[model samples]
Target: MRSVYMQSLAYVDANRIYSRIMELGEIGRTKQSGVQRLALSKEDKEAQILVTKWMEEAGLTVSHDHFGNLIGRKEGEKPHLPIVMIGSHIDSVRNGGKFDGIIGVLGGIEIAQFIYSNNISHAHTLEVIAFCEEEGSQFNDGLFGSRGMVGKATEEDFQKKNDQQVTRFDALKNFGSEIDPARYKESVRKEEEIKIYLEMHIEQGPYLDVNSHPVGIVNGIAGLSWYTIMIEGTPGHAGTVPMNLRNDPMIGAAKVIQEINEICSSQPDQQTVGTVGIIQAFPGGSNIIPNAVQFSLDLRDINLTRKNRIFAEIEERLQAICQENGLSYTIKTNIELDPVACSEEIIDVFTSIGKKLDMDIPIMVSGAGHDAMLMSEITDIGMIFVRCKKGISHQPEESATKEDIAMGTEIMLQAVLQYI
Candidate 1:
């Protein structure tokens, strides 16, 4: 099939798009004028209801998967063809900004809404989704919905617990999801079922904001490796155990954690980054020595070779640190993936449209993680980024102009229509 060429965009209701974004924000409005709609929370349910209403009004047939991802379908002239999928998550962090994931969903809906209202003829069906728990703030695991959709979610994902001591299993049940937690494989969409995937999101960094570009094309998302390192040592009384004689896991953990920073920073301009997001020491007492220490390391980089070498160096140093401190250790690789490149075909469409629109579209490699990365496992993926103020995101101050978002939507609309 060939793309349907359009000399101009049929229409994109910028006002309606902005209004919907603000409307969704009102559901979990925080004192800081942000959103706290964690996945499966009450606020998330409220937002889902409102979004569902909007989807129906936009002429979509909406339904919920067993995982609770809100999916909306718009049938095309040819319904059996692999679908063109677009959208992002609606669930936000504890106090996230209004536009992070909201733009992609609303933008995709606007495209679908336009196609339906204008009665535009297309050969492939269009699908929009507001994936559940992309923020993962509730269950301490992000990308739950996207991963589930792609069959990448692991057994450890659904078993994770929240701060309230509630397992994800119970939380999904409370939220009206038909998930068994043990076996929710029905939600996975086969690679052949999707033609391509697209998403629009805030830059979440200052590149575009600093360059004063309203919209940017994402070249790719960085690869990431997550490791849970455990250090074990003999427990003893802090007062009685001399520092020279004690086998201390905390000492080993501290040394390894510090090395993680130094190793990733070795190549400063390479964009290699490593962070220890979590740390825990057992026998939490001022007078007691920790018997074990557990910590999480998140390493990411656009260059896979650099990322791997850095991780290897960290592990090498970790072994030395453990041996020096008389501690035994284990490393659990929770997740590891190579960088995902955007679909060059879809990317060319965006760039052409941007040039036609007289917009300067910057191509950037994402340093942060995104659901688009997982979609890469199944289908061609493309991402458009709208500039947020100062590149701030995941907080109350995260801001993206309605005009920028509309501009990105217009580009997406034109580009997606080409595929039809």
Candidate 2:
């Protein structure tokens, strides 16, 4: 342990890691000065190559899986030891910030560099992976890479195409690689293979930055449910449609949206949130009474019971509104993802390291989902939270200071030492 600590102190240069992140930030900037490296795009593939180069320079054995996730492994004395995995996604939403996902990947690489330089030997290996996609901005699929690795993805999901009509399998081929039809199941990491997993990411919200806390120890990830609500009614000329004589789906939709918001507001707060992200009207013209309206509802909560209750309330309210208005409607839940809790054992290690470093690490729940959520299913998982400037993400303006990132990186290194 003394040797490991000395190894970390000797080779871990926070500023160097910071420079690398800033440099990568320049390579993938969008025209708007945001980021645009969505899943399988030319930019995304190029970033993979760049990081793989760094992996080689760090002296780790590097390879990519059938899912396109890049893994860099540092072998320990015992080759068959269970690995301590650390990584996050490299893909971003349109105009996303730099630190959202890449921080974990880079931090892990830095740790591996330190281990190699100090000749630190351990029973467990350190594995750093760059998840292919976490943001579903370009493709309709999110966590595609992680899901494929864990064998959670179905054949139908692989068949689903992106905006370019490129299937997930074909998208990999476009990058000069092909998915083995038989090896899809081999992608999942068995429970015995991974001892633990840790990820470092920007808070992506204002809590830590506003509170003047330098870091956050995440407690659990929120569960989410999404549904598309379609309302059907008779379309008629606006001038001819009498107020009382017409069956108006638009009117019902408005009432339902209002009720949905109010119901969510009325619930006991446990980090529960609801949103209506998309709304569309058929024949959306000023002069025509809308005959059809489709909208999407997203409900999320850290506590599973609260999420289910809110979801049920919205469904009941929508049904009542449609029946009362005599309008035909349909509600389809596109996805209902379960919540994930972090490993208490791993969380304790993070907290202990933060104390030794004299960092004020607050405990918080991640409102947004992440690759860590998927990794948690197979391993004991932990996360390090760097403070974002304004607690904002998924935009060109999303920012985090260099100092905050450096602080998180050092803390992460300490945690790696303890884990190994």
Segments of candidate 1 deviating more than 4 angstroms: 1-5, 177-183, 236-240
| Candidate 2 structure quality by residue, lDDT tens digits, 1-420 | 335544223346778778888777776797888877887788887888888888877778888787778889987667687888888988888778777798888878888887776677677888899987777665554777777777677777667678778887777656645445346677778878888888889888899988998889998989877788999888989899789988788898999999988888886664778888789889798888789999988888888987887877888888888888878888887666789998888788778777777655788999888888788777888887888888888888888776777777777787787767
TM-score of 2: 0.92
Clashing pairs in 1: none
Clash numbers, per candidate: 0, 3
Candidate 2 local lDDT, residue 115 = 75
At residue 314, give the lDDT of candidate 2: 83
Residue-level lDDT tens digits of model 1 in 1-420: 333566876378999999999999998999999999999888998998888888888889998776778899988788889999997989999888899899999898898888777777888988999998887688766788888889988777777898998878778777765445555787889999999999999889999988989999999999988888999998999889888999999989989888988787779695998989789999678788999999998899999998888888888999998888889999998778799899998888899998899877999988888889999999999999999999899899988887888999999888788876
> What's the lDDT for all of these models?
0.87, 0.80
TM-score of each: 0.92, 0.92
